[model samples]
Every structure is written in structure tokens, then in C-alpha cells.
Target: MFRAIRLPRRTLLTTAAAGVVISSGLDREKLPIYPTPNPPILLVDSPSSLEQQIGVARRTVVGTYDNAYSKVQDVVSNWIGVEKAVENRIKSLHDPTEPLTPSLLYVGVATLSSTIFTRTRSLPTRFLLPPTFLVLSLNYFLPKTSTNISTYLTSLEETYLPSVAEKHAIGRAHTAMTWERIKDFTQESREKFGEGVRDAVKNVEGWTGLKLGETLRVQKSEAVEVVVGVTKKVEEKVEEAVAKSFVEEKTAVDKPKEVPVKRLV
Candidate 1:
């Protein structure tokens, strides 16, 4: 009983250390890592890895999805001057009869930013698709709430952070992918993304507080777009792999067992 509580604390310290180490390996190409402290719930690094260790793959997919999201921020930031315009244009495109409201614009940018960035970074797209589908289904079926605070707060977060993240994604991906395209952009990105990375590192303090039972200033509720997005993604992947294995097993069973080959006389 005494050791159980201490185990989690020790694991957190060890995981945080591991995060720092793994993050260090990720160059600016994968900079601004979101550190997590749960060593026990480890995430998989790639699809091949997931195939190897199905359990760990579930966790790793979430981490990889996080990597995908960090890039989403980069894409949005790059859209700065153009993001607003892009957001506005898409909103109008979606609504032919009605005038685009600020609210509509907000959702538009969030969806568009995520969509476009996902195209460039298909890992997250393939990863995010099922989750987005689930959340949209949830919103459609369960959106009604009896309370006002929940509604108002949800509205507010949906507006601000997605806009912010979209803009950030644009900027950072421009740097990372640009450098990825032509190494010349590497120096350019280090200078530009430096502030973004620095700010990202600084933002960790607030989220860490949430884990410790402190309130997140930004109403992590909106960030549910991120949380649910990521969670749904990882869950779907694990489920898919499991389903695939079961299908394979069933296929083998349905077919006649192979007869042992006899050696030729």
C-alpha cells in the first residue's frame, strides 16, 4: 500500500526525464515537444512499432498525434496574414445564404487550418480522421446542455485557441517543412521558430499545473479539440489493429487447416 503511491511519483520523474531526452533528439524539425510524465502509459513511435507491441502502440499513437498537432500549430501561425483571409473565405464558401459571423469564421479557420495542415502531414490526417468523425457525431447527438456556463465557456474556447493554433501551425510548418524542402530554410526557421519554440516551452508550466489539480487558464475545455482529437485518434488505431488481428485469425480458422506436406519418395 505504501509503495503504490510512491511508484507513480517515481514514474513521473523518470518519464519527464525521458521526455527531455527524446525531445532533445528531435531537432528543430520536431521541436517544441509536449512533455508527458506517465512512464507506465508509454506511446508507440511508429506504425511498425505499433504492430510489434500492440499495447504500447496505442499510447505512442497519441504521442505521434501530438507531434502531428504541434505541426498544426506551425501551419496556423504561418497563415497569420493569410489565415484570417483564408478562414473568412472558407466560412463564406460554406454558407452561401447567410452572412459569415465571427463565430462561423472561428470554426471555419479551426477546421480549415487543421484540414490543410493534415494534408501536408498525412500521419495526423490518417490519425485524426476517425476521432473527428466521432466528435462530430457526439456534437450532433449530445450537444444540448442544461447549463449556460458550459455553453458560454465552450463557445469562447472554440473561438480563440483554434485560431491561435491555426496561425501557429502555419508559421512553424512553414519553417519545419520549408527546411524539410530545402535545407536553406533550416537557418531561417531556427531564427523564426525560436520565439515560437521558446514560448511553447514556457507554456508547459500552465498545463503541468492542470495535472497537479490546478485549473488551466485557457479552459482546457476548448483544447478538447486537441485532447479528444488525439484520444480518439489513438483509440481508433488500437481498435483497428485489434480488429485486423481478429479478422486474420477468423480467416485462418474459416479456411481448412493446411495438411502437413509429405516428403517425396
Candidate 2:
């Protein structure tokens, strides 16, 4: 048999508590050690330098201008294309053609009509003959006439249109100048009118020995009092007249009407 050694109660409790603490610490150390996530990396962009910012702004402005220039170039090219097409079409219509055959035929028809008009005694025949000749002449001359008109118009455009444009420009400038003068005159008139009004007010003040505003206010108050008094008198007179008329009507109603009696003889 082993000999039992007696220990103090406090000593036994201390030993048990130490044993429990040691066991718990060992258990915690055995637990899976999860690594703590590194603080989230904040990737902050560095602020742009002044020169870089200026460069960016310059590029943006240049890009906008370039885009506008390209758009204008496209519009101008399209306009030029349309103008060329129209010019080509007009040139095709004005191209020269053989006119000899048509001219000879027209002359023959005209001569025959003129001879018939002179030889024929019939008035209707003569009348018809002149119209026939006229129609034939027009048919022959219309093309030449159109060509000549076109040439005249072209010459007019080149010579007179510029002068007309210049005259229009001059007229516009004159109009602008006239408008400016009118505006100046109106401004001066307004200033003069203001001054005249001020002088008139001063003159009125000197004559009346009162400020214009105060004088007007006084006159207004006096007029209002007069109007009010007149209105009150009119109202009293109306009431008295109405009351008298009502009393007369009541007296008339109260009086009995006399019955008419005819005496028979």
C-alpha cells in the first residue's frame, strides 16, 4: 500500500486550476490558425500634374476643332458636288445640234403661207395663213432665241450681278448706319425728355412752393374729400327724394277712388 500524503485544500484547488489553464492554452494552440487578411490595398491614382492637365485640355480642344473642320469640309465638298452636277446637266441641255434641215423646212412652209395669204381673197383663209406662218416662224426661231437668251443671262450674271451685290451691300451698310443714327436720336430724345420733365417739375415746384409729389398728394387728398362730400350729399338727397316719393305713393293708395254714377232722367 502506498502512503497517502495530506495536502491543504487551497493547494489542491491551485493545482487543479493550473492544470485546466494549461489544457485550455494547449487546445487553443491546436486550433486551425487562419491567416488574417491583409488590410485591403487602396490603389489611389496620383493626381495629374498641371502640365499634364493642360496637355489633356489642349488635346480636347484640338479634337473638337478638328471634328468641326472635318464636318465643314464634308458639307463644302457635298455642295461643290451638287453644283458640278447641276452645271453638267445645264451644259448637256445647251449642247449644239443640227438646225439646217429644220430651218429649210420652216422657210418653205413660211413662203407657201405668205404666198397663199397674198393670193387668197377669202378673209378666213388669210387669217389662217398668217397664224400658220407665225407658228412656223416660232418653231424655227425658238431654239436660237433660247440660246441667245441664255448667253445674255450668262453675260448679265458676270457683269451686273456683282454690281447689284455691291449695291445691296452698300444699302445694308447705309441701313445699319441709319438704324444707329435712329437709336442715337431716340436716346438723345429720351435724355432730353427726362431733362425737360425734371425742369418742368422744378418750375412747377417754384411756382407752387411745394414739391411735385407732395403737391399732387395734397390735390389728390383734397379732390377725394370733395368727391366724398359730394357723393354723401347726393346720397342724402336721393334718400330724401325716395322717401318723399314713397310717402306720396302711400297716400295715393290710401285714398279711395270715387265711383262714377250716371243719373238717368
Candidate 3:
């Protein structure tokens, strides 16, 4: 049993009065007083306000995207225009019908040098031939070849590109038509497949007096079981074969070979 210690009412009142007196006697101005913290303010927007904010954000993003796209398009158009201008300038500078005389002359000199170097067994002449050929070709042949190539390309572009573009357009149209035909065929096939599936379900329902869903569920379960059984048997057979092979290998490795003794004859 627990005993409770009780204080007299007069004594308790005296203690409380003393505490209040002591607290009041202390200077309240010197005591630190902390201010109470305010609760966090949560602003919840209504549906209309939220939708308006979303619309503003969407408009900003779309405006940015359009600006960026337009800038890129401008840059690409400017680049294409500059490229065409440069190409036209180059085509105007070079004549396509210009003679290949310098290039031919360099080639002949190189060939003659090679022939002379091969026929003559003179070491100094052979040594001189290569450098001479190099100088002649570099000074004459390369520039002439480059000019001829540019001229040829310009002529070909002027003559061939339009016809080639027309052919490409025709091919693209044919490809589009072929794709449309393929799409129609696939759609027809899908419809036929759906009809066949519905017909099959009706036939099954009529024959078995059971719902097609139930029949399909039953069949699926049986197929799963059969597949599981076959897989188990195959797994067992494979494990047995592996174990047999491993044992055979281990025995072959462990078995000692007999050493043949040679007679001293």
C-alpha cells in the first residue's frame, strides 16, 4: 500500500505567496523576453487562378520555342544563300571548256621520266628523276586537275540536277502510293482476323455449351501444365547427361597410366 503525503492548505498558500513575492521583487526589465514566432503562411490558389498561371507559362514557353526556331531557320537560310553565291562565283570564274594541256604535259613528262629512269641504269639520273617529276607535277598538274574537276562538277550540276530531282519526286510519289496500298491491305487483314476470331468463339460456344472465355482459360491452363511437364522432363534428362559426362571426364582425368618397361636386349 502507498501512503500519500499531504500538505496543509495554509502551508501551500504561504509557499505560493512567497514564490509570487520573490518573482515580483526581481526587475522585469532585465529579464529576457522572447517574441512568439508567427505561423507559416500558405497561399492556395483557386482553380481559375491556377489555370491562368499555367496558361501564362505555356505561352512563355511557346514564344521561346518559336523564337529559337525562327532564329535557326534564319541562320540556315542565310548559310544556304551564302553557299549558293560562292558556288555561282566559282562556276563563273572557271570555264568548263578550258583545255587540259598543262595537265597532259605534266603527265607526259612524268611518264617519260619514269621510262627513262627504268631503262637507264645510271644511279645519278635515277636520283634526279624523282625530284624533277615531283617539282613539275606539283607546280603544274595538281592545280590544273583541281580546276578541271570543279568545272566538270559545275557543268554536271547545271545539266543533271533538275532531271534527277524530277525522277526523285516521281519515285517518292510511287513509294507513298505503295505504302498506302500496304496500309489498306493490313487493315483488311486485321478486320478479317477479328471476324474469324468472333466466328471461332461463336462456334465453340455453340458446340460445347460453355462460354468461350471459360474454355480458353481451361485450354490455357492445360497448355501451361503440358509445357511445364515437358520442360521438367527435359531439365531432368539434361542434368543426368551433364552428370554422366562430368563423371566420365573426372574418371578419365584421375585414372593413372601404366608405364611400359623396356627390356635390356
Give each model a TM-score: 0.17, 0.27, 0.27
Instruction: Name the lDDT value of residue 83 in candidate 2.
Output: 100
lDDT of 2 by residue, 123-213 (tens): 7776577767765574565566446545655566658797776676688799999999999999999999988987898898889877896
**lDDT by residue (tens digit), candidate 3, 1-265:** 9999999999999999999988887856455588768899999966798899999999999999999999999999999999999898766654555455676577677867775766666887777777677656644656654565656665675577977766766887999999999999999999999889978888988998879867777999999999999999999999999999999999999999989998998
Candidate 1 or 2, higher TM-score?
A: 2
Worst 10 residues of 2 by lDDT: 91-100
Global lDDT scores for all candidate models:
0.66, 0.79, 0.80
> Looking at candidate 3, what is the lDDT of residue 149?
60
For model 1, what is the C-alpha lDDT against the true structure?
0.66
How many clashing pairs does model 3 include? 0
Q: Please identify model 3 stretches exceeding 4 Å from their true place.
A: 1-188, 199-209, 259-265
Angstrom error of the Cα, residue 11, model 3: value is: 99
Q: Pick the candidate with the highest lDDT.
A: 3
* Poorest lDDT segment (10 consecutive residues) of candidate 3: 92-101
Give candidate 2's TM-score: 0.27
